[model samples]
Target chain A: MSTTTEAPQVKETTKTVDFKTIIDIKDMDLYYGTYHALKKVNLTIPEKAVTAFIGPSGCGKSTLLRTLNRMNDMIPNTRIEGLVDIAGTDIYSNEVDVETLRKKVGMVFQQANPFPKSIYDNVAYGPRLHGIKNKAQLDEIVEQSLKQAALWNEVKDFLKRSAFSLSGGQQQRLCIARALAVNPEILLMDEATSALDPISTLKIEELTQELKNKYTIVMVTHNMHQAARISDQTVFFLNGEVVEFDQTDKLFSNPSDKRTEDYITGRFG
Target chain B: MNNLFQDANRQQISGRRRNDLIWRILFLGATLFGIVALSALIITIVTDGIARLNPDLFTNYPSRRASASGMKSAIVGSLYMLCLMAPISFVLGVGAAIYLEEYAPKNRFTRLIQLNISTLAGVPSIVYGILGLAIFVRTFGLERSLLSGALTMTLLVLPIIIVASQEAIRAVPRARRDASFALGATKWQTVSRSVLPSAISAIMTGVILALSRAIGETAPLIIIGAATYVAFLPESLFDTFTVMPIQIYNWIARPQEAFQDLAASGIIVLMIMLVIMNVAAIMLRNKYQKNI
Candidate 1:
């Protein structure tokens, strides 16, 4: 598809070789009342790789990301058609409890919305929701989740401190730890670091790199460079349609679609 | 002309300052008007009733002799009624708020119900008294006992607590609920653990204010037949009761000047009870806010 232009750069992406598909979305269409938000979308996400969805504002990348965990169901009058099969089961089916689905597919929001609680309680909130009430077990999960989110060192000493006491960056990471505390199979991040400063963004990107080794990560980002730096696969979306989905370096260096090239190169979004 | 703020007309600025001073004084006067009125009332009551503030006020029952009469029965009865009415109103009101805010879907029916509740909060307390008369006193055969009067007071204040609780619950940021729900907490869990905890202090403040209004109420209890000159304290829910307001009202109606002075002493007692309730609520609010 990039027949005319010579490829400029290729970052090594050798790890995508053994990726096993864990999420298969087919013929998926999402509608909010009268307006169709996502149309005829098909995607297969690897089990333990960071797949970033990149698009302009209102381009349905975030909409698609929300559909992955049915977070969009919170919106009234929303409808979904076709299949979103996670680990070989349709998440939208009647038998699938929405709460359990959310527990398994944890999410971190754009704004770091930690509960008005202690740092330990914010992390332990998830485990307690699933009925893990033993103090020792909760303490261990809190420690492990905070460590996984790279926030243990900053907050471990003051575990009883209010979550709002943390700086914005630390709070965002605390939210990440909160999501990870549930021990989810997939972590959906909807512009999770966009609210933070550049240094915090880098920290979250680095955290994502380490986190993808264990959990399948789906992230929606307005920052193309963030997608390039952290994602193994990049899905470029335009007007609710998948314009191009490919390995991150391949798409950035030599996009098959002209629109993808324009958006990535900052010619126009 | 080069400086965009060129020559701001010093004379005009001075004139504006004079006008601003007038408005400032006006607002200050408006604020002081309320304080002055209240202070004058307290001064009058204190000067009139200071002699009645002796140990005799606590121990003596109502008597034909003005100096010997005390509010012992009224105080005990009022306290007992508050203790009875408070729990019932709090549970019903807060429960109604939780249902409307968390569980009930927003629809025309719920909007109508909410509208009615708001209107009920503004309706005269006398109307609630009448309702209590027809229902609790007559239909239920409870008569004009403390239970009937307490239930009427509950009815009078229930709308207030519900409205205030709804406001408190609504004031909680939606993000907090979202945070809880995202962690796989059920709707009830989210509301109880997250939403309620954040709103409890504000809700308590509202409850205290509502109860304060209930405590000062005279007409509802009067309509429910609170005996104005009870010699013995109310012993049970079904026992005849007379509250402080009714006691004070009865004294004020007497032609005797000493009885009027006694009424002022009763007024002081009522005000003290109110101040205590408000102070306790503020302390609880501060404690809870700092606890988090």
Candidate 2:
């Protein structure tokens, strides 16, 4: 891993932390028009691990997540500086294709957004777009994705039913299945369980735990407990800057930064 | 409660109830007036046309003899014109709407174009007839024909369809497009596969309504020189034709009482055609709404 220089406190904190880095953000800054949304944010997300971004509202956690897949490029008058490297390749490089980058990095939104199609079609949508047309192959992929997302048994009998017929939690899982159908390497969930009931939230947390074994997962969450429960590394953000980044257990138990402790202790956010 | 407060409250409640009753009755009378007027019109038309309703109305061509007068050519002409106008306007209007809503940059130019379209929708139908006369008839040398008349109606209703379709396209939530994009679907695939399907029922409803208006229009057709009397149906796009409105107008102008009755019968047929078209539109909307 490349050494993250100074703030002597961060260096002292990282001495006990160890992981194989897969995504490295080096002195990154992002602006939406005149608004500086992220300011010299540096982070290293590890492979096959769940990294959680915990921050108050409007802290730019979601903005940083979107930048990973170049989704920020869709917004008008948005600009980025410095490097965002995924798997040792600079994603913002001129040669990178946004479509191919998105194909490798899947995202789930705060609200479940399933297409207004059949349950089977929802999972099969991504594969179909990439030119997978064989019926048997599509069927296999659909079943595998839904099963992987843990939505197959409930929906397998009625694959032709409209996706809207499913509950909100089921719809979110279907969206997960849809993303997985594309065979992405990294999964980004931006408060994916914030809209769900506690039971559904637990189910998704469990799914995320299972999914992290195969796919590198990064999630931005409002629930600190969720981050504590699922993440291997926890990054605390405040005011468009990273306040703390350490092992999840270490950060919660012995936070290095005062702001991180204050925010996490329900003192102020 | 204090006696004074109770008295005041009771007085206010009774006064408000009295005012509410008066307004309710007034609104009910207004609604009844429209329904009663419409029922009277239908009764009058049905009664007047009942004697003229026969197999001859559908089979025989218009003639000087009132007994032999029929709307065969007019019916065929209207249907053929509708077939041409519906598809043409739907394709053109929806295409323009999609471009404006999905692809066009939001700028002063786009706002100006949108304002122009809204203004165009409110322009007099006869103004479009005059335009058709200058462009399709004189400039293009098409003369007074079915093609010219259909083209005029198409222009007359095109603005309405475009405006309605733009609203429909705009109504599709951005999340659907985002989902499609995140899945690596190209812009075209996202539109055709998701956006269009979601907005289609509304677009079809708008197109069908515009076509209904086109079917009933007479001022533009007359301005474009559609035939008032045609014994034979239009054999080709270039052939002269007469619509039900034009045929009815011709009958109502004559001094003969029998011809006036025939006009009443023609009105009934036109109303039936409109009802059928609207029912089809409603059915299409409901069918697609279920899927969406």
Candidate 3:
């Protein structure tokens, strides 16, 4: 069901906007040692929307996601140039605390990487780190986040059980709950559901939809169908460059670039 | 064609015969050598030492006369030395290992430290003895006391402890660290809360094995001047000490036939202690392996 039509250019209009841009990345370049992983890239992520980055492996989708939270700073010989501003503050600025920036910008990995701890402890870890000491407060957050993840029912009885003892799908949802418990304004997910079965993937996709009402989400996924099914805005990346970015409907049904069209149709990676 | 076929068959038969004969000889020779060596050592020790084994060996203190003597003093002294040495060595070694494995950046200095530790592990026991004599005994004024010997032995096996502990800590999968960090824990928090607990058994195994090695060391204690004929048990860390190996050495060095018997008995005791330590290490290692 391919449809090719030019996106209608908007006429000049003026209105008062209430929402703010949560993340503003401009001219961002990332290098692993001497290899340029992400060429100069730029994007503005709006608040409270599911923004999906779709690309083949090694195209720098994950790199861009990591840079949003300064997670790449952990790797030795990894260097970034250009600006990544979150909430009007440059995350790369010398005065900004990396831990505080990370606290506000939570991340989930490709694999379900729950800590080798109790489910309750795993969910409570983030809040505890940011100096939440009240037992009642942490308990409330853990229960609320788990419920939001649609995992509270399955795991509530076994809250004290090890996170590792959960099923793969359960573990992934637990990780999501953990990220949510911290109350981050922006959530960065790097192929969060790529390792789960289709049923679990659907659950996470649904949860992502529910979460976007409160938190802005930027996810990297290789699955085109997943991007189309879950995301509001889709950015198609190829060879460390943004090939096409539009509404999900437009990007999938009426891709403007030949490369995006080919990738979407499974003609080539 | 007939000639070629015959020649091929003959060569094949000869090669097969040679191969079979060589394989048979090698297998039989290895088995025979292993059995002979093990039996000879066991029989020699048991036959010579079994006569000295008695209840008093564990109950009474050492004496000048063989008929009145027991290994109680040496046993107590060895236990006390282990008590002091194990904790000291474990703390120093594990701390060094954690710094090297988790925090220390890869640089020329760390590389040099790592290399030096490996080389030190290979240094002869006697050299450690001399160093202990010159340093702990003289400079520290420990005066050939149990503390001096323990300190010397600690240095002797410190490298082994560090190496083993490093391996254990490194064995903890990187995913654990990533998980902890993603949860917003700091580096030390990640290590102490997650990595160290998972690696505890492996670290313990290393510590116990090193301690076992230290317990059996005779040269260092002898060089540090452990007394041979102490009638009283050591009352303090500064008191002169004699370990099982040193006592056994003293016994074996005597011309009296009875003293040689005492040496054999001491060998049995030392062997039993070593076996117990090794078994504990193996158990700890297995427990962690199952969990991880």
Candidate 4:
């Protein structure tokens, strides 16, 4: 559940009681070619809540996040074991379409990669591929997605300009807008703010808090403060396995596991 | 003792510096040798051909009389061959590159195919001439027509186009493809919408360079039995043809002294056509580059 904030006290009060399990992972294991990338991991993600995955480098947080939408399928010789179900549907089942899964679970990457295209085209790319051809509808989606990412006021007049013309922070926000344009139910952020400056990183954390009301959000972060500030639930990972899963405040204040406590206190990674 | 060691080190340094100076002068001489040879060849060609450069070169067809002979049919025929070869090579070459770079699994078979393509680019044009003669010219019964010659040239330059295009496609960043795929795009959608657009300028540059090689090719056309004296323009794809190189070769072979100037003039025209083609390619590449 989200912690209390003065400005949104009423909204925060309402959000704490309405939580439902949306993603259920049971004994999930993943491998890349013959190397195990993720060990047996089990967790439940609540709908319309922000979850953060915090760990050291090479701890498999990003790998586990990618498996949520089957993005790991793109890698050659990658194998997954056990179940990862979203809304009661097993995503690893043969009948499950990876593309459709990805549409429902949008992802933003560590590096902000705006296609070498106009801003309008970058946002419209997802919808256009999903078969929306109407100019008016595309324009509406582009406008709404940009406004949601808090980038519309800066980019509205020059929609036709190339996306690369923007600064790094703007480009990362543009990537978020691009992911939102598809109307996904879940958003995955894989170190999305690690490439930005402190100010840009703060802006993204604020955005995550605002976005959690409408979408289930999972973020992988090296910055523990950002995770504590934004996420409602926190999962600590170590050596491809989860060390602890608890409410954000409890995990930060009184971690149940010694490793989690060490990591949180900067004793050792 | 320290002074003696220092003196030895300084002696070694001076010796190495002298060796470096010698190698630098030797390398400079080698480069100048090549440049001097090339400039001499250019000067000879220009002096020989400048007086004979006339409008008749574009208006009249080939003739036994050196004064009357012009490169009309040969110029038109080479252009026709280029027009036919460019599209065929671009589609097949770029498609194969995309498949190899984007879709093919990383296995032994793909590696072998890539190795063979690199090897094929090194194979002589004359060998391709033999292959064309055995296949398109005889087996398909197309004979020495424009279509047969174009097909042969396509095979000759196909390897170069494929290799260059593969390099271009491979140069595209992995991040772009990941971003596209993360947005629910299928494989082809990611390639065509994102990857291809970013690499198109490089692809165009490669294709144009390949097409230029195809335009100047003579061995394959000769082996395919393209007629040396086709007076009329090729009205159809099946019509017999002779490209610029073959025409210039014929002129150079003639015993008459005047024919040498005529050959030089043909060379000039051929070079001009190549320049024009390259310029057009650069313009197209620039337009696509701006979009990316």
Which predicted model would earn the best TM-score?
A: 1
Expressed as tens digits, the lDDT of each residue in B184-240 for candidate 3 is 678887888778988889899989999999999989888989897777789988998
lDDT of 3 by residue, A1-269 (tens): 22353332221011103335788888888899999988878887778888999988988888888888777878889988898888888889998887777778888888998876789988998898778989999999999999988999999999988888899999999988988888888888999998999899999998998998899999999998989988878998888887778778888999999999999999988
TM-scores of the candidates, chain A only: 0.94, 0.93, 0.91, 0.95
Q: Per-residue CA lDDT of candidate 1, range A1-269, in tens?
A: 23454442221234467688999999999999999989999988998999999998999999998887787888889999999999999999988998898899999999999888899999999999999999999999999999999999998899999998999999999999999999999999999998999999999999998999899999999998899988999999999988889889899999999999999999987
What is the full ranking by lDDT, best candidate first?
Answer: 2, 4, 1, 3
What 10-residue stretch in candidate 2 chain A is worst by lDDT?
A9-18
For all the models shown, what interface RMSD does each have?
1.1, 0.9, 2.1, 0.8
Docking class of 2: medium
Order of candidate numbers by TM-score, starting with the best: 1, 2, 4, 3
For all candidates, the clash counts are 0, 0, 0, 0
lDDT (10s digit) by residue, model 4, range B65-96: 98999989999999899889989999999999
Give the fraction of reference interface contacts each candidate recovers: 0.74, 0.74, 0.30, 0.79
Weakest 10 consecutive residues, lDDT, candidate 3 chain A? A8-17
| Segments in model 1 whose C-alpha atoms lie over 4 Å from true places | A1-14, B1-8
- Between prediction 1 and prediction 2, the one with superior TM-score is 1
Query: What lDDT does candidate 3 reach at residue B279?
Result: 100
Can you give the TM-score per candidate against the true fold? 0.95, 0.94, 0.88, 0.94
* Inter-residue clash pairs, candidate 3: none
Return the number of clashes found in candidate 4: 0
